[model samples]
Target: MSVAARIAGPDLHETSVAPRSRSRMLALVIALAFAAVGGQLVRLAWQNEDASTIRVSMMSSPANTLARPDIVDRNGRLLATDVQMPSLYADPLLIQDADEAAERLVRLFPQIDVRELRQSLADKSRRFVWVRRGLSPAMAQRVHNLGIPGLLFVDEIRRTYPAGRLGGHILGRVDIDNRGTGGIERYIDEIGASEAAVGARLSARAPVRLSLDLGVMHALDEELAGAMVRYEAAGAAGLVMDVLTGEVVASVSRPGVDPAVYEDALDPSRIDRIAAGTYELGSIMKLVTVAMALEMGRSLDSMVDTAEPLKAGRFTIEDLHPLGRPMSVSEVFIHSSNVGAGQLALSAGAATQKAFLQKLGLWSALKTEVSSGPAPQKPQQIGRIEQITLSFGHGLATTPLQFAAASAALMNGGTRVTPTFMALDGEAPVVRGERVVSARTSALLREVMRRNVTDPAGTGRRADVPGFEVGGKTGTAEMAAKGGYRKKSVLASFIGTFPSSEPRYVTLILLFEPKGQDVTGGEITAGRNAAPTTARIIERIAPLLGVPAKSL
Candidate 1:
């Protein structure tokens, strides 16, 4: 201080103020100016900072998109669930070198077009752009390591199927925003399950429980898949249902689709055959015809002549192995005689046949939680030919699901049963529908069905599980084509009920276009393939269904 005062002249220091006071004031003014200049520089730096290094949250981006709830089987087994995943996005305004960023990203994702991405990133008007969606954790980490500017990640919920393709047609699929699009997934949305939930967080509601038993479903799936390979069949479909409650415990269609793969569901060849398509069910329709005969005061032992082939215009209806004698009604069912069934239909008249079919619910479409199947294709009028063919499962096409529902009613003691996919909650009583037949008629039908499995010459003899007492009908019909029926191609199917004395469950197995095999005695009949397949399925699923194997 003394040196500074000496250097400054004494006259200058003493003129207006003390040297120490003036020096302090000057230092304070300088400090204030520097502080203002430092703040401006810091502000400019922040505005120009590299956005790639910064993390931007898109929490409120898809605010209206609500997460879906878990879909579980009857035993609380997981089928479908929501999982948190990081989806990639970009802020175009923050992208400094758009060309460089796009080029780097294209290397990681070969599917992305670099030029299109470049244009998207170069547009400063849009603050956000989608880079990629539904990225796996490993995939997200790989993209993060690239260190591209403007690229960011947002947490979102995506639907995941745990069992892969199992129950795909039943569980359905979701959209990009996690909204239900088809199957039971869409049913959830229709019931307002996601109405109140409008965020990325998953639905807090208790999981949706289906009537399907995972163990039984797996058994059915495996058996059907094996059947397809064993029989050299083009496709296969099967279902197991609780006859009393009308609950479809298991439904599977081969060449099964995966819910995660949207394209698979859209494929026509991969459609759910159980409930999605209608087919001329061949001999299975005789179940309805025989039920009509029983309901019309005809005894099981009543004889109907099948000595001559049925002639209708240009068509001649006959049995594959005609007995060439007057056959009893019970024999008519056991043999699956087309001429016999046609006679029963003619005796009852065409009007009676149509009414019985309509009463059985086979004359219309059957809508389940899975799908509203195409309406049954039937003749416009019930002429002699139409009535004869309809009686023996031709000139009329209905879904296997609809036919199953009708059969369940017959097996469940005369009461109508509407097939359902939803589980009956709690100790809810099994509400029975209107009686479609007399209890006496139901008992007679049961007696004959039992004979069909036990009798040596029965068409369904191959379908008998040792202790399950399976009774069913076999069908092998030439597949219909543009002009007429395809001679060699057939839809082989068997529909049976277990513990036939008092039926509990109904099983329907279908094998489409099965080829002749040595094990089948070089025959492509339902008894050779579909019947034995049904037997195998019954043996496997009966234990899971709580239907204990009875002592032979």
Candidate 2:
């Protein structure tokens, strides 16, 4: 009886243990299944986060674009902005007939090279290939209607110029990948104002505010365009700069490049003339000569014998409109007497003349947010002939921008003025550059400039705007050829300052290779073309610049 009971008890215990083990195994399997599912979900979440924070290296791929800050004028008018645009792409591996696709695409865009696209699509190894970037909605829809397999669209940020060609030279262009190429666009890159983006994410940073006054810019462009037609000029350029702050309020070059069309900017003939081209600026340089004399302890009444032409080597320096008499320092400036300027420069000698030019920032390269101005082309040797030619601005060639900066210093109470395309943070920093001339000398120069325009016989009389008290000097410089200067193809320029009593803005107007026209009285001189053009510009832009007109 005992043996049988023991055997039965062992069997029951074994059965109970087997059922418990099975239950434990089932629980472990369920736990492992849930763990695997939970891990999969976590991995998917991690992948999404990684995608969102992915950093694209722009240097590695040209297709990787940048997110740039908005560019706005001082008045908050939009100049340039990044807009979302649809871009066409192809999965080369999935494309069935590359040749057919290329042919169809060419029908939609005549600009697309069929052969090149066919080659790009034939590369089945490439997963993605760009067909076209920045397509308009209509073009995108047409491509979509084709229902071509493997053709896809991706949203991309594209640079857009809302002002059209108004401030094109200053606003600059971006490449196909939205990278800054020139002008203030390059400055934005240098200042870390742009972000590299993998996709179509927009920039959320504050807009970059420029010193340009849109109203004034448009006014200047209109005036220059009209002058180009009125004077029959090959080209024209104009700029307005704050005399005290060095801020360039408005700048324009006719035959301007539209920033939206990058190809136009690449054209050599459409380059920015204000800062990119250098020229012998002619008689306007007499202002520098006069300033040098004043700094050398000569007063406005100081007289220079200008009765004869100045001879240096084989070159003779004579006034275009000679007074044929001894000229006072004031008269020399007003008359733009090349003979008197040469004599004054001879008195100062070469070293002093160069020093004065350097101090006025006319002898070196100038840089602003828009560009590093083309370096000044100074005479290699400052000998007698060189000095004479330089006195009237022929031997030394400089960009109009550099010349305008020097003129600004002369009118801003003897303090040096630097030109800038970006707006000042607040009040302009007090100019700390070394004083080039005495305040008294600056005032005297102002008086002479005013007289040059106010006098009925003054060359710049045509530049005068009533109530605005405009004053300026005229310059006509022949373009330098392979060996010498062209006789007829001259660069006519006029630099004007307003309200001579208290100067604010300085304007520079230039006409390149102008021809005789009825409006210009059949003359190509600066007084006939550039001076009157400046007058028109001032009349329109003065009110926009907030310059109050004096009561008649």
Candidate 3:
């Protein structure tokens, strides 16, 4: 072959190999590009699924929180408010060593259970776990200094009671997530006065104005605390309410619960005495009997034979200080004669007596802004024996709040008064309740109540405060125990009305298991304990309540 032909053939063979190599390299590059695109799509889909799972878990674990408006007294003083606090959480999956994490956390917060925390952290499946909630600024700072990798903090709204233990029963308590559990706090939720919160959002609604006068409440609390110490009592409760408007001015129950410490509220001894507890309040029931008598057209001077002990089925009711002579209706109240009250109750038949009490809202359950007061326990059958026993408050049990409202009806010119914790808005329309008694009967009842305080022989004379026109009735009821009444453990109470001529407010003071002291002349009667307490309370709160002192 010629040399030129051989060279051209070699060059053509090299050209064909170069074109095939270029085609193969192009296809390989395209295939790699398609593979990269597919990998990116798969990674994105996995990430999205993971995010969706987290979102679903978050939604399912409901974070219960409430955005509540400020609770203020009638004077616009803040009682309860929401404050921002740091809440701690941890990413369990991110924790490298759960034992070390839990140990460090427990050192910072001794209250934390180390074992539970360690178990929670070891659960790598769990992404989140609550470490602590409602941490104070100082506490949160200490936790931050720990430098734990998985630990984190989020701002949360927390309930704070500025008044501490003052009016605790009225203000009530909230849960860890800030949802109200009881008292006025729960009422706020029930009435739609609060909103669900997301994050640290605050309520934009107007503050809830309560009928409570902060000044009055503080004074009442101070006085009741002093009384508890002075009388050596197990517990004490007191309340002041507007007779005409039925607005609770001040109320206190001791051993008061601190709203900040939620556990204190659950204690049985710390229960709200003014509304939550029922007691057979002894001679205080005489107020209802006397009112019933007056409603039946009996005059204050009407006489009833209280010389003999009242007999019931296997029971005998006798006065502590029997007059031995017949007592006039007014004298019976002044002397607190249980037999006379029984006679009066019998005069008004069982049906009429029950009907009268029901009319006064004392024979059934009562609901206020604070709570649905326990239903009054009455005899299943209002037989002759039951009627006689109920006349002097031995067989019937009612809350002081219910009885106070009923008494207010008798003093507020016979209008039915429904007690309220919310402040009444003057601009808002008021739906007045039905009248419970004749105005004439109410007038006579007021006169008798005043006489019970002013007369020298009256059991409530100690309750009379100078210039305040304080008029009240004393009650000393034996406390009921496991099966029967404990004679020595008496509940002393005073139901008082100030400026009896006008009767603007009613105050009730109670001392449970008060001991006889030198100041009380070794007497456990309400006249020695609760009556004086009422006088002190009235003198201090009347001025704050805008009740002017009158000339004697």
Give per-residue CA lDDT, model 3, range 196-306, as digits (tens). Answer: 876777789899999999899989898988998999999999989999889999999999999999689879999999999998988898999999999998999989998
Question: Judged by TM-score relative to the true structure, which candidate is superior, 1 or 3?
Answer: 1
Write one digit per residue (lDDT tens) for candidate 2, span 1-552: 334544566575466566567678789999999999999999999798666545443322334789999999998999999998999999999899999999999999999889999999999989999899999999899999998899999889999998999989988888888899898999999999999876787899899999999999988999898888887889999999999888899989889999998688889999888988888899999988988998888988989999999988887777778878899998888878889999999999999999888888888888888887888888888999988888988888888888888998899888888788888776645555567678988998899899999888788999988899998999998999999889889999999999788899999999999999887778899999999989999998888888999998
What's the TM-score of every candidate structure? 0.88, 0.88, 0.87
lDDT of candidate 1 over 1-552, digit per residue (tens) = 545655676766464566577788789999999999999899778875554333232335545565677889999999999888888999999999999999889888898988999999999999999998888999999888988878999877889999999999889899988888999999989887764333457778889899999999999999998998998999999999999899999999989999999899989999899988899999989989999999999999999989999999999998999999999999999999999999999999988899989988999888887777689999999999998999999989999999999999888899999988989874988899999988878888888888888899998899988888888998898899999999789999999998898899999999999999989999999989999999999999999989978898
Question: Which 10-residue window of candidate 3 scores lowest in summed lDDT?
Answer: 1-10
| Candidate 3 colliding pairs | none
For candidate 1, the TM-score is 0.88
Off by over 4 Å in 2: 1-63, 427-433
lDDT of 3: 0.90
Clashing pairs in 1: none
Top of the candidates by lDDT: 3
